[model samples]
Target: MPSHETTPAESVWDYPRPPALQRDPRRIVVECAGQILADTTGALKIMETSHPPVFYVPPGDVRTDLLRASSHHTWCEWKGRADFWDILVGSDIRALAAWSYSDPRPPYEDLVGHFAFYAGRVDRCTVDGYTVRPQEGDFYGGWITPEVRGPFKGGTHTHGW
Candidate 1:
C-alpha cells in the first residue's frame, strides 16, 4: 500500500480496495458549453483505494435529452459492464463523456442507471460549488476535490499499482 502523511482531510490511500458507496449530500453540478447537464444533491460517491471518488448522479436530476447513447462499453471486475453516453450541448458533442452501469452486479446494484461524468471532458464539474479536478488518465472518472488527498493511481506511472 502507498504511504502518505495523514491530515484532517480523507486520504485516498486509506480507501477500501473493492470500493464502497455512500450518499453525498453536497450539490454536484456539471456544465458544458454554457449548459447544465446534471445538477443534483442526491448523488452516490464511490471511494476506492488510491483514487478519488466518483460521484454517480441520479437520472431524475440530469437533462436526459442531452445524453445520447454511445457505442463504447467497458467492464469492471467489481461493478460489472458499463454503458457510455455522449454529451451534446447544441452543436458541441463530447463523445463517451459519461458512463453508467445499467445492470450492475451485487453490492453495486444501486448504481444502475446512475451516471458519472468525465470531469476533464466537461466544461466544468463542481462539488458543493468547488470546482473539481479530473482524475488523471482517460479511463478513470474519479473527481478530485479539495477535501480528498491523493498521489492517485490513474496517472501513467501509477498504473502498475
Candidate 2:
C-alpha cells in the first residue's frame, strides 16, 4: 500500500473550467517503441480540473519523420479539432498514441501543431528527469510527475467529472 496524503500546491479541483495554458521550460522527454520520440525544454503545459498537466511539445522537437498522420479526429470543446498521430518505427505502429491541434481554439492557438502524447500508450515519459506516471485510465493524456498531487479524473469512478 502507498500513502495517498498530499498537501498539494495546486489542486485539480481549483483548476478553471476553461483550463490554463502556460509555457513550461522543463525538459520533457518521451521514449517509446524503442525510439526517442521527442525531447524539449520549450513545451507548453495545460492544466484542467481533475487532470494532471498535459505537456505539448513543439513539432520541431519531435521526430516528425517517424509519425504518420491518422484519419482519426476528435473535438475538444476548448482546444478545437484534434488530429491523431500514429508512431511508425520499422514495423511497429502505435495508433492514436499522440494528438495535435493544427488550428486550436482562440485560447489555445499557441498549441497549433504541438504534440501531446499519451504516456500509457508509450514506453516512457519524463519531466526534468523525473519519470512520469501516466494519468490513470485511457482517455486523458496527462503527465504525472512527482510534484503534482492529484485525485485525477482518468481512473475508475472518475468519469464524466
Candidate 3:
C-alpha cells in the first residue's frame, strides 16, 4: 500500500557503483528512428539525473557518420565539456540530439570522450531488444537498460506518455 518500497537487492536511492560509472563495453547498441547508430558494448550509464537515467557511450561506439557537429552546448556542474551533435536523417537534420564530454572532471573520468544521445529527436530508440521511449521535456531514454521495471514511459500505466 506504500507508494514507495525498497528491496535488499536494489532500489533507486542506492546504486551499488555510485560514483564510478561502468559500461558493459561489450555489445551495447542504440538505434533511433530508422537509423542504426552507435554499436558498442563499452558505454557508461551515469546516474547524475534522478528522474531519468542518462547513458554516455564512447564516440567509437557511436555512428559518427550520421552525426554533424553542432554549435549548441550544455554544461554540467559535475561533468565538463558537453558537446552537442545533430542527427542527419536523409535531407533533414535534427539539432542537438546528441552530446559528448570532450573533457570530464575528476570522479567522472570514465565518461570523458564518451557521448550521450537525446531520445526525443529520434523517431525510435532501442537498446539490445527492448525499446526505449524518450523522456518528455528532456534528452533521455528510460528503456535502454535492465535496471528499469514496470510503469515506464509509453506503458499502460503511463497515461501522460
Candidate achieving the largest lDDT: 1
Off by over 4 Å in 3: 1-10, 15-20, 25-27, 139-146, 149-161
The deviation in Å at residue 117 for candidate 2 is: 0.6
> For residues 64-156, could you state the per-residue lDDT of candidate 1 as single tens digits?
899999988999989999999999988999999999998999899999899999999999999888888999999988999877988898999
Ranking of all predicted structures according to lDDT, beginning with the best and ending with the worst: 1, 2, 3
- On the 0 to 100 scale, the lDDT of residue 46 in model 2 is 96
For every candidate structure, what is the RMSD over all alpha carbons to the true structure, in angstroms?
4.7, 3.6, 7.0
| TM-score for each candidate, following the candidate numbering | 0.94, 0.92, 0.72
Q: Please tell me which predicted candidate would have the highest TM-score against the true structure.
A: 1
Q: What's the true lDDT of residue 157 in model 2?
A: 91
Number of clashing pairs per prediction, in order: 0, 0, 5
Query: How many clashing residue pairs, candidate 2?
Result: 0
Give Cα distance to truth, residue 101, candidate 1, Å: 0.8
**lDDT, model 2, position 33:** 81
For candidate 1, the TM-score is 0.94
> For residues 50-113, what per-residue lDDT tens digits would candidate 2 score against the true structure?
8999999999999999899999999999998999999988988889999999999998999999
